[model samples]
Target: MNAVVFGAVLCAGVAAWVLCARDEAVRRARTLLVGPWGPPGPGCGVPGLRRLDVRVQALLEPFRVRFGWRLGRELLCLPAGLVLSVAAHSAVPAVLAAGAVPLVGRWLRGRESRALAEERALAAGALCSAVAGDLRAGLAPQGALAGALLREGWPGRPALADAALPLLAAARFGGDVPAALRTAARLDGAQGLAGVAACWQVAVDGGAGLADGLDRIAAALRSERDQREDLRTQLAAPRSTVLMLALLPLFGLVLGAGLGADPVGTLLRTPFGLGCLAAGGLLEWAGLAWTARIVRTAEAS
Candidate 1:
């Protein structure tokens, strides 16, 4: 009777999932957020998969705006949890997975954000170096900035793209270049803009060597990037340890099954086993979350 009830529940969940796949409301929302076609995907040639991907992204756009990128992506766990519940023939593991999704996404999100920040820092250094080179090549300060900004893409530093319009207007139309740089500095990973602003101001006011100041700023940014990279490398061992500890229970289950213990059956079918499973899952989750919080706090500081 229990098995039959579980089967019925799983079937209902799957049917709902399928209905959602072709829902007009979902499609309408996707269209409203992402437009008629979708955002440009790679030339991967998988149109159907790519379309679905874009639609999810469209739906999650608000989540992304409201929260950050990490939670927005992690919110997919609501449906993913249902899928897991359906697959496992039990709800315990699915509930555990749903609860653990944030902890799961945290390390990955931190790594991605750190890498992007490092790239942005490197790009900032490159920008400063380019401007310095142009300055030494007989261009005025404004002309040097203009030449630097004209370089395509800005290379892994899309955040800097925000500054382009204001910087251009200032450079070309006698607006306050230093002020623009300072404003741009307010962006994450672009704090070097503040240094550039100070340099520009000193050069304009005190007749200091702008090229020399810019070269120093570029070198400092590069050094900061290297320091961050080294720090991440040092932290890798602890990250691996934490991740391994989190997966140890799965290893234990595999070992038990190899030793002829029906661990899976016990956990799924027995009340006491289910309680232990829930308790163990929560402990694992809390441990991961706590460690992740510490790591993030350290990184922030």
Candidate 2:
């Protein structure tokens, strides 16, 4: 009976999650296509879903600063963990799982930020190269920068666009282009823009060769990008090792089940099993955290 109920609840939860996720995606897609904040589409326009989204968003508002706009999605783990605890007939694991969700979300957000920085870094290099070409073709510095940014041949245009907005505005309005570049440089992966700003400042102040300086900066960024790619390849081994180790607990459960043992019932109903589960989970979390820190340290260096 418990198994049947758990199965039904899980099915319902999965269905709801899928439908909600699809609606959100569709709404976002439509909004993008319309080139503005268009009306919500289909399921998203339903009051129940709309209110559910708003209420969930409100609940997660306090966490918005740390997690950005994705806190609501992370909070879904709470109900998921609850459903799992129901199946396991355990509240302790559920509580721990809920608590870990935010930390896990934070870790994921950091990884995403790092990846975005890499994209922006590559985009910055492309922008600099294009700007140099435009300048050599006799375009004004502002025109060169604008044309380079507006081009659609690059992979990281969205990231580049976000980082270059201030620079673009300054160029268009004649509002201290070097200062704008410096502001854009504050974004992750946009450190190259600082060099570009320095070159611009020199050109503006002393008539130094801006094109030549930009070319050098672009070359340096490309070299750094290539080195990062090589380093990532080297780092993949440790990442894969950590992932496999993390899955060992699940593998153990599968093996136990294959041996005709009631592992789930044993873990959920017995005190000794619960204690072991708690200890093992804590150690697993610690191991992952420690390995992640080491990888981040290596990446930073």
Candidate 3:
């Protein structure tokens, strides 16, 4: 009776570690990647990647909803691949494929983000050129702003179409240019833009030198852009190291499996192996969560 009771307790513990406990760990790790709790369901939106997000989110729904958290698209695929691997009675391909999804997503997102960023940069550059030309022609800040709005054909014209143009019109009809730029800043989502608009607003409102203020604001933007670039360069190496570190143990397991080692069979069949697999999966998720937190901190800074 004693031995039977011990064996039952051990089996319960193993089951908890593999299915129930690991799912919880995966969910917690996901919450770290996305903002708190996510969209409250399986299908969530990832801006600019809706279709892919929905598919991945659907696949991840079971793990997430059951565990009360969200998971990264990449991590969501991992368990599915793992389950498939076990179902197909193969472990090596499962782990490798699971790990590759996130890396591929990251690469694709990075490329797209870079292209969008370049568009924004070109828009800013055109806006600066207009400001410079207007300044050279002795236009007051209000006059220059109006000219830029009326000029048309500038990159990101819509950025100013609604708020800036209407504000400039009001200024021309005897309203405040500073107020208009401030309104523009408020409407658009970029702080640098708001800051530039505010600088112009202050210049016009306080009767400061319009050209000098524009130059100063542009200088500040240039400094900020430089700092962001430097930070990205600094972060690249450390982020790669973290990813490589995370994959090391999983790859080692895969290597064992490829060598015809029965780690999966043992993991599924034996109480000790199951507990270890469960513990390892939890630890892997915890490590990824920790790494993600570090990245978030860096990004916020």
Candidate 4:
């Protein structure tokens, strides 16, 4: 088919994919995370096709995980390719570009997720350390917690700060130290902190010591922090390789389509060529799927 007709078909297919995804979301009572080439919303799309998306997502997840890339870019690229195909009037280049978009998107998403996760983990660790030290130095748990949170400039600090006001009220008006402690714990991003606060709250009600509990929490947080860093280090090399492998074929295919022999176009032009093209696409997808599986297994190991 000519580029215009091919692009229209491709666009129609994408539209169908999107519509199906939307229907599936509706049937399942789940929010649609995104609309075709649009922003995400919860429970906005197709339910039946979400399973298909999960399969696609699974294949893409490893690449996104390893490369620190955004899934959105890969997603956007498909529509971009369709639009580009229409504009380029060249089926080969458009098809090749369309195929490459997801890899790029996942890589971007992975990077963003990694950075955010690290920051939160580090903040949790630091908050743990600061609270332990401050409490030991005779500061009330609230004081220590507030100071730690302030120092970190946490992304969600405003919400935590707002939560703290009612907690402070609970301590002052109700004379309920336990309730206050629980509130403080909830405000902090540290899940372990909640446990510690609960313990202290109980201790306050019953007149017990919390020094030991605080020490244990600090130690645990520190250990967890170290483990996360070590895991990141271990995965670094393999992640790099996964990204390269996932991207290389896409780049090569596109380069071949655009610069080398126009096999994609030939495939479109002839029945035999079409069979070969379909086979090649299938093989390419299989290889990508295999590489993604390997990456995930390696990451898990």
True-structure lDDT of candidate 2: 0.71
Query: TM-score: which is higher, 1 or 3?
Result: 1
Tens digit per residue, CA lDDT, model 4, 1-301: 2464455466546645543332222212222221132223223266555566666665666776799643532474566575755555446546776767766545555544444344444555566677678878998766666666556553233223333445445534555555554555543343554666666666667766665666777677778777666877987887688658656744554566666566445555677876776787787679768866875676466
Error of 3 at 138 (Å): 4.6
Clashes of each: 0, 0, 1, 30
For model 3 the TM-score comes to: 0.53
- Clash pairs, candidate 1, are none
Residue-level error in angstroms, candidate 1, position 5: 22
lDDT of 1 at 275: 85
Off by over 4 Å in 3: 1-129, 138-143, 146-177, 183-189, 268-271, 299-301
Q: Candidate 4 overall Cα lDDT vs. reference?
A: 0.55
- C-alpha RMSD in Å of predicted model 3 compared with the true structure: 12.9
211-237: candidate 1 lDDT, tens digit per residue: 999999998988887877787797899
The deviation in Å at residue 287 for candidate 2 is 1.8
Taking all chains together, the TM-score of candidate 4 against the true structure is 0.53
